[model samples]
Each structure stands twice: as C-alpha cells, then as structure tokens.
Target: MENRLFYVMFCMILLLSLCSSENYFTKNVKGEGVLAKNSYVNHPPNPPIVEGPLVGLTRKAYQYNLTLIDPDNDLLIGYEIDFGDTIEGSSCCPIPSNTTLTLYHMWYNPGVYNVKARTKDGHGLWGNWSTPLTVTIMEGDTVPPVVHMLKPNKGLYLSNKRILPFPMNLVIGGITVEVEAVDEGSDVSRVEFYVQGSLKERDYTTPYSWDWYEKSLGRYVLTVKAYDFVGNQVSDEIIVWKFF
Candidate 1:
C-alpha cells in the first residue's frame, strides 16, 4: 500500500511539471499571457519617388522613374501621378515591390508645375504622396483631359464582359461616385458628377469623388465630366441599378 501511494504521488508531480512547462512555452510564444491566434496587420507602402527632368520642352515626352516600397513587403500594383498641371495619371498594372518604373508625360504649355507621385500595393492600400518636383515646360500644346468612372461598378461584373440589361453596375445602398482624370497637356480643373442627366456635385481636387444617397430605388445614369485648364473637357458615364 505504501509503495502504491508513492507511485501515485510521483505521477501527480510529473503531470504538474508537464502542465507548467506547457504554460510557460505557450506564454513565451504568444508574448502575451493569453492563448490566442496572432493577428496580422497590413502596413501601407512607402511614399513613391518621382525622378525626371526639372525643365523640358512643351509637347515633348519626358521620362520619369517611379519607385515605391511596401512596408509589409507587399507587391506594388499601380501608381498615381499628379503632374502639377492639375491633372493626375494612374497605372493599374502590377509590378514587383521595391522596383523602379519609367513613365512618360508631356506638358501642353509652358508653366512651372509641381509633379508628385504615390503608389498602391496589392492589398489596395495607398501610400502618401512624395515630395513635389517643380518642372518648367518651355512650350506646349492643348488637349482635353481624360475622365473615367471608377466606383459603383462591381469589379467582377464589369470587367468580365458579361452583358446585362440596362445598368452595368448594381448597388444595394448609397454609393460613392469616384472618378479618375488625366491630361497630357493641360491640367484638369474640375470634375462634375451628374445623376440621371442632372448635375449633383462638382469636385475641384485630386481623387474627385462624391457620395450619393438616394431614398428611391431604381436604375440611374451616372456621369462624370472633367474639364482641363485650357477649357478642354471629356466625360464618362455608367448605368447603375440601386436596390435594397
């Protein structure tokens, strides 16, 4: 009876030691005294670097090198460039992280423009804009700014080429109208948002966007018109069905 009691006590002590060791390891691995899965946080990319000519001739294409680095080591998919002509340009192609890309642009007229750049990572997060580079154009031409609708259109449905009835985009709640405007010559002055042929709002800055809330649910035509510094204009429209 005495030997059996001793064996039982030894087993109990061993079990307690094992449990204590497990707890210690677990706490060390977690670094917090709790048992939980580690959460991942995505960091945005670093500000982009725009390198090009500080002074060039008008209407002549100048090469600019754009370099971006993601803090989380994510892949960079695109770039947003503000040419300081009041126009912005974007590239939606994926490129490796921490790499330099070359882009070409020309000024339509002679002016001192502050060019800046930013980047978007694969996770759809945008970084801050870089320091501006003042560029002086000698002589230039004139062209209308290019505009396009970006939001409210479901990505898969619109890009897939699947034909639908009246509206190309389907929205269940209030939607935001986002636009991308670019000009090679003159800078964009303003972007106008219209719904069902009526002007709703006008944005005079980069990342032109307007939030639209409609009580009634139905199909509506959304239009975005962009005007350049030279009074040149362009517009793009999209049809959307808003329902519950």
Candidate 2:
C-alpha cells in the first residue's frame, strides 16, 4: 500500500508539470501570433497632402484636392477637412492609395484662413492632421495697380546746350527718381525700385521716390514695381542715359 501510494503521488506530480508546460507554450504562441495579427489591423493612414489655390474671391466656391497614402496599402476610408472658419466637413467611402479626394468650400467674408485635413484607413484609425494651408480671400480685387515712372523722362537732354557741343552725350550730375502708382480697388501698399537688376529702394507711402546722390554714368535701366493692398503688382521700367 505504501509503494502504490507513492506511485500514485508520482503520477499526479507529473501530470501537474505537463499541464503547466502546456499553459506556458500556449501563452508563448499567443504572444508571437498576436503580434503578426495586430500588424495588419487598426493601423492609421498617413497624413494627407492638400492642394488648392492660395487666393480666392469671397462668395465664390473653391475646389481643393487631397492626396492620401497608406503604408500597409489599406483602403482609405474617409477624409475630414477643417476650413478654420468654425466649419468642418467629412467624406466617406473607401478610396485607393494615391487617389485624390475633391472638396469644395465657400466663404462669405474676406479674410485669411487656414485649412487642414486628415485621413482614416479602413480599420477606422485616424491619422495625424496634415500641415495647414493658408488661403486669402479678397473682395473681387482683380485689377492690378497702375504704375509709371515720373522722373528722368525718356530723351531728356541733361547737358547744358550752350556749354556742350551738339551730338555730345547727355551729362547729368544727379537726379531724383520718382514713381506714381494708382490702385482703384485698393490702396497702394508699397513700391520697389530696382536699378540695374538690383533692388535699391522700397517705399511704403505716397510720394514714392528715391534721391540718388551718386552720379551715374552710361546707360542705366531703372525699374519700378508697385503693389496694392491685395497684392496685385505692376512694374514699369525705363532706359535712361546718364553722363558725368
């Protein structure tokens, strides 16, 4: 009876060890298997790239396109757009990778706005928001500023006729270059002057002119560019002959 009891006790101990080993092997299999399974599940899509016009007219509908890519080739489920005007929109449906989603929006007031977008994959995971795109809305200011050079008129003979002989080059000591810009829709914001392809002066107010004290010799190209409040720009250039 003592030997039989010992044998039964040994068999029970062996069965318990086998059960423990099986439990540990099952846990190891789950840890490795679940990693592979979860890799393809619930992965977020990549951030989207938005493309559209940076400037648009108020009350006019503007269309924008968003491009999305998924790392796991998961189908893009939807897109969300925030116009930064307290308004948001969403699009639903499965779209393939590299497919562009189109959306349209209109603003009633003229102002600057930032637009942002996000994309979701088929697993219902939302990615991070994309970089914002800035948009400026104007109130129908389409006409460019009218600009012209005022000083150093073309064909002006600077040299004194009595002192210099005929057919001599026009010699000038110094001259003040001026520009006049007019904008009917918006006020003139600034004017830029370029001499020989180099920017020389920038004027922000009226009576736009630069007093060039240095005497210039030979042919010089003077360019004046004017901009309005709405960023409409116009440039005018003139060829002037200077001799010292």
Candidate 3:
C-alpha cells in the first residue's frame, strides 16, 4: 500500500513540474495559452488612394497625392510607389495615419502609365497596392509654373525682443508677402496667396504680392500657388511668426 501511494505522488509531482515549466501544454487550453505575451494577429492596411492629372508630358515632373488608412489604426511608416515602367520608388519615414503625401515623378518615354501606391504599417507589413490611376503621357510642354517666395526668405529675425531661430522669419505688426512666378509653356494666369491654408488674396499681374495685416499674433503658414494658362500649377510656401 505504501509503494502504491509513493508512485502516485511521484506522478503528480512530475505532472505539476511539466505544467509549471515552459512546456506548451501548461497554458495551452482551448488555444489561449499558445500565444506569446502582448502578441496578436496582424492585419495589413487598406488600399491607398492615388490622385493626379490624367494627361502629362514626357520628361516633365508632375506631382501626385497619396493617402492611406490602416484597418487596425496602426501608424504608417513608409510607402512604395510604382510608376508601371519597371521603375519603383520608396519612401520610409514615420507619418501619421490619414495624412496626405505629395510625390513627384517624370516619365522619360511617352506612353500610357499606371500609377499605384502601397503603405507599410508600424508592424512592417506592407498592404496591397491601390487601384492604378491611368495617365497618358505625350510629347508637349506640360511643365508646371515656377514659383518662389520673395519675401520672408528663410532667415533669422527679431520678434517681441527675442532672437528667433535662423530658419524662422519673424514679422512685426504687418508684413507684405511677395512671390515671383514664371511659366515657360504658357502665360501665368494668377497667383493665389494663402495664410494658414486660407485664401487671402489673388494677384493677376507680375510682382505678385499681398499685404497681410491680421491682428492675430502667432505663427502662420504662407503659401503662393501659381497657375498657368494651360492648367499646369505649382506652389511655394513659407512659415513666419507674426507679433503685433
């Protein structure tokens, strides 16, 4: 009887040790114990959105906007852009979810091209490429207008008796924002000036400028978008501090 009791105790101890150790059977009841700590099944992001012009010119740079969303609400890290001509470009950086990114590309040969993009999640998983945007490239001058911010050039300035950074421009009271725009293919139609993404003024003549006098004192984003007679457009922007 004593021998039988000893044998039963030994078996129980062995089973307990196996369950307490790193054995798979210890916590693996009903598939709950098999997963590692803080681990879950990863899902890829949804298809991206590609928006741009449908007709372009060969050997001319054109801009396209890309936007994406992750089904799991994960942060985006990078993107893969395919121009459908055996050339691919990739951008890697930490970008917020649902943010739109602008990319530029030039085609060397004239033909029909399909543009597509895919996003990479925080988990390093690449989602599917979006539906291709068909673009037809031909031989012509489709170059966008060239724009430059004349005033508020990147430099240091005084604001409220404090020395600002070298790359920041400080404005006291009111400042005149000016830009220079030129087009090689067609005449410039108009230049639109924007402050904090709001349309402030429109200049239809050369020496494009706008007098910005707002009582609100803070940092503002100044943008100048120039459009040509042929619908080709380009933009230039600057950041300035307003203290008045």
Candidate 4:
C-alpha cells in the first residue's frame, strides 16, 4: 500500500510539472494566448443602383431612385451623384443601409448628360461608383434632330472623327468646324457650338460653319447642340487636339 501511494504521488507530480512547463512556454515564447480574443470583419458596401429617366425636358424637375446594399449589413452613411455637367450633389445626411432613396434635379440647358452615384458606409468608407445612366435633355422636344460633323474629305473620310481614338504624332493648329443639321418635322431653328463644355458661338442659318481658332495647345471636346422650330433638339460631340 505504501509503495502504491508513493507511485501515485510521483505520477501526479510529473503530470503537474509537464503542465506548468507548457504554460510557461506558451506565456513567454508565444506571448499570446491560444484562444482568440477579439475579432472583427468589415467589407465595403456594394455599388448603388440608380434609376431615372432617359430623356426629359429642360427646366423640368426629374426624380431619380438610388438603392444600396452592404454585404456585411453595415449601416450606410450617405450618397453622392455626378450630374455629368461638371456639377456634383450629395445626400443631406446619413441613412440606413439596404434602403431606397429618392432625389430630384433640373437641367436648364438641353444636351446629352450622364449621371452616376455612390454610397458611403458607417465606417466612412466609400464604395465604387455605380454604373452611369445616360440622360438626354431636350427643350420640350419630342423628335431629336439629325446632325453630323463634316470632315475635310466629304466622301472618303467619315464625319466627326473622334480625337484620342489613337495617338497621332502630328499636331493640329486650326480646323474648320462645320455641321449639317436637318429636321424632318420642321426647319432647323439654330445651331450652337460648345468648346470644352462652354458655349462659344451660334449660327442661325444654313451652311453652319465656325472658324474655331486654337486658343491654346491642348485637347478639346467640341459639341454642337441644335434645335428645331417645334422645340425638338439634338447634339453631337467630337474630340480634337491643338498642338500649335
């Protein structure tokens, strides 16, 4: 009985010593406990869903709908929009995630514009911009005018050559900008010219041509907005570069 008791005590002491050594190694060498303490996972919100009219009249208020989804179910803060006219707007305050939002805007002038939207999460992280929606504004116009840019070579070269479509070593100094607009419903009222999104000149007669001189050496987006007598409007744009 005595030998058996001594043997049991020795086994217990050995087991206790092994446990203590393992704990010391874990505390000193590893520095952190084996069990996980605090853990967190975060993900950015998904792109917003934007819905609005494709065509509308100028000076008229248009309503748009936006919806956002967060995979992690995080709270959304706010949203913003790019009106494509060099104007940007945003939500008034933070809102709940996975909800729909409605907003309104008006276009004073008639043109083809694009609108984009994005949302922010509660963590102040902004998600990717949503796919753009094209909005065409008209002057209470039902029928869009038919217009095209005339090239130097009438038959051989296509009209309205897009600049930056390909890199060219040659520089362009000045080019004659001309447009031919025809309306089936009514006579062409006027043709307006725009350079880099700003109005430059307008012609009220046929054989519409503008002597656009290169003010500086840079790239420019030339646009023409035309209207008919019955309020029908149309627009066309081209990219050009001026080296000299």
Candidate 5:
C-alpha cells in the first residue's frame, strides 16, 4: 500500500516535468535557449547599381533601379525617393501597381542628407519608409591627364642579334629602358610609340628615312608600349644596341 502511494507521487512529478511553462526568452533546465526570428516591422527595398547611401554633385543627376519585394499578389500603388534636402528636380507619381519601380532624379543639394523611400500596396497598406538612402553633394576635379615616358622607349622594341652576324667592336650598343602610363576611361582609344633604344637607327616612325646611325659611345635599348584609355598597358622592347 505504501509502495503504491509513492509510485503515484513519482508519476505526478514526472508528468509535471514533461510540461514546460516558459516563454521564448527563457532558458530550459538543460541550458539551451529557444529564440524567435527578427520581426520585420519596417524593412526597406534594395536598389540596383550604386548601393544605398549614394553621393553626387548638386547639378548632376543619377538613376536608381528600385526593386520592391512583393510578399502578396497585391498591386503596388506608388513609390518615391525622398531627399532629406531639396533636390533640383525631384519628382514622384503613382506607379503601375507593379512589383518594380525605376526612378530618375536630379538633386540640387546645398546640404548633406538621409533619403528614404515609401510605397503603397493595392490593399491600401503603406509600407514603412525604406531604410534611408543618403546622398551627399560635393565638388572636386574630374579630368584625367595624359601619360608619357621621360626617357627610353616610351615602351616599344625587339630585335635578333644572331641575324646581324656582322657584329663590330665599335658597335657599343645593347641597353634597355622602360615606359609606363595611365589614363581615364575615355578619349583617344590608345597610345603606341617606338623607342630609339639601339645603335641601329634614328627615329623609327618615318619609314622612308631609314637612317642607321653609328654607336660611337654606348649601348641603347628602346621599347614601345600600347595603352587603352582605361589605363590598360601592353609593353614590348627592341634591342637597338646589343654589343656581343
């Protein structure tokens, strides 16, 4: 009879232990915690191209491809980019109630700012202002300068000494020099020039005047390099003066 009574009490305690009576923030007896997903009471849309917080000149304009994620099949009603400060030509209007909106605006800012966006669903529920996209208006230089070598092959040249078996002691030649450069993405497509880096010649470009000069003193090497407006370079060399 006593054993039966003790068994009933143990069963009641075991039943109570199986039931947990705590909320999401509480840790269980085993030290493990159950957490909840972050609620998106207010999340903003992501724009293509320049990631949010873009900066531009006051007089200059830029375009943004704003994409709205539609959780429901409801119609998207309207959208706008709110420049915290006054922009030169900020415009806003009703959208086709579609999921995507493309926006173009010229901002004239005498100020620094935080810009946010807003849109409405067909169900009349206006979403929270998008995470603010800031635009800072400032001024600076934009022009890119030309590139050239101070000496040697402005980078272009190559030759075969083995072919010129008629080698000489007075042929004090065979030296190498380098050329380098950079450019803005626009302008003349490229730059190519020859180097007078050898005892073999004078002025390479003018072919008819094929004048090969004597190397009375020292060796020389010249190279010509090609460059694109975007600053990509390809360089090659010519051994103008190779003394064997």
Candidate 6:
C-alpha cells in the first residue's frame, strides 16, 4: 500500500508541473473556447469603418487589438498585420496586455483588408491565423462639383456638341460631378469662374468661353463649386488636356 501511495504522489507532481508551465499554441480547435494559463488561441480583433480615399496619415494611437483569452495566460511571443497585397505589419510576442494596432489612415478607395495577431507560448504548438476581419473603404464623399480629372477633357468646347466624359485624378473613373449656384433660399441663380490653372481670370459667370493656346500646356485641373439660393454649396474637380 505504501508503494502504491508513493507512485500516485509522483504522478500528481508530474501533472502539476505540466499545468503550471506556460502553453504556446492551440491549433485546430476554435470558436468559444478557453486557453490554459500562458496559452494563446489565434488571431486578433476586427477592423473599423474608414472614410476618404487615403484617410490622410495621422499621428494618432488607434489601438485595434484582441485578447488571446486562454485561462493559462501563457507568454505570447509576437504578432503580424497583413493588409492584403503583401501589405504587412508585425511585432514581437508576449504582446503587451493592452496592445492595439496602429494605422496611418482609416480610409481607402474601395477594397478589403485584414490584420493578424500571432502569438506563441513556450510550447511549439503554432496557433492558427487570427479571426480575419474585412473592411470596405467609405464611399460617402457627397461634396458636389466632384472634380473628376486632372487634364481638361477637350481642347475645343464646340457649341451643340456633347462634351466628352471628364475624369478625375487620384481616383477611379465613373464618379459624378456637377455645378450650380443660386441666391440665399431664393430662386435667383447664376454661375461664376475664376480660372487660375492655365488661364488667368478674376471673376466670370457660367457658359464661359476660352481660346486654346499651344504656349499654355503641361498640367491643369479645374475646381468648381455650386451654391443654392439658400446658400447651399457643392464642389467638384475637372482635368483639362484634350487637344484637337
């Protein structure tokens, strides 16, 4: 009996040692589960909605992180962010308990992207990729006169001729742009132009005309804004570069 007791005690010690040790990775298993102390499951949290074409890079701390959520709470090794098309960001493991993903901008034209949080414990069980979160670049740019191109559409604006489709730079084609002006909350309306790129003009109204000049050539984009009688406003861009 004494020998049997000794054997049981030894086994208990061995099991305890294993439990106390940190867990490195838990593969295959997923969905609503717990991790042993020092253990990690997989991946990171989801991404948020972004606006604008490039959401201009900002110097802000937008911590987008997720929890490993393993009861063992093992010592995680590191992480990586893969934003499609070979775009990637990474960090060492044993991730900061309060770590978050930092981004230069929140907006993109239109597409899907994701982030990955890689964690490794002292164990060799490599965890699977984190839950992938997809995001669609915001498309809510309602500003009017939506300038469409960088180069003017035509060298000649002949009367009674359907103008060719104008395009915008730094953006994909098929975007809508318009111009209009009106009095404050009144029906009165009119349009004006202050050409500056290649032509010199101070103030003028719509249905304006200009002569093409060979001397004036290189780069030119038009910016126009329309206002309503009630003092409403809209803006757009136009590129001028069509030659006869």
Q: Could you give candidate 5's per-residue lDDT for residues 42-118 as a string of tens digits?
A: 33333312234377655445676666554544446555556675432222443433345555655544467777666
Model 3, TM vs. native: 0.45
Q: Taking the tens digit of each residue's C-alpha lDDT, what string does model 4 give over 14-57?
A: 86886655342223355864433233567888888889999988
Best by lDDT: 3
Candidate 6 per-residue lDDT, tens place, 154-191, comes to 43333323255534322222222223433333332333
> What lDDT does each candidate get?
0.78, 0.77, 0.81, 0.74, 0.46, 0.40
Compared with the true structure, the alpha-carbon lDDT of candidate 5 equals 0.46
lDDT of 1 by residue, 1-244 (tens): 9999999999999868866663422355647665424446788889888899998877667899988888888888878889977556566677777898888887777889999888888888988989999998886545789887878665323322323433357665565677899888768889999989999999999899997765537878889999976567889988777664
What ranges in model 4 sit over 4 Å off? 1-34, 91-93, 141-244
In model 1, the runs with Cα more than 4 Å from the true position are 1-34, 86-88, 140-244
Summed backbone clashes in each candidate are: 4, 0, 0, 0, 23, 43
Candidates arranged by TM-score, highest first: 3, 2, 4, 1, 5, 6
Model 3 ranges off by over 4 Å: 1-39, 142-244
lDDT of 6: 0.40
Candidate closest to the true structure, highest TM-score: 3
Q: Lowest-lDDT window of 10 residues in candidate 5?
A: 202-211
Give one digit per residue, the lDDT tens place, for model 2 in 1-244.
9999999999999868855552322234446522112222356778899999999886567899989888888898778888878656565678898888788887767899999888888888889998999999888766789998767654344442223343433437666777889999767889999989999899998899986656677887889999987667999997766766
**What stretches of model 2 exceed 4 Å from their correct place?**
1-116, 119-139, 154-171
Cα lDDT of candidate 4 equals: 0.74
List the lowest-lDDT window of 10 residues for candidate 1. Answer: 155-164
How well does candidate 1 match the true structure in TM-score terms? 0.43
Candidate 1 overall Cα lDDT vs. reference?
Answer: 0.78
RMSD of 5: 17.8
Which ranges in model 5 have alpha carbons more than 4 Å from their true place?
1-53, 86-98, 140-244
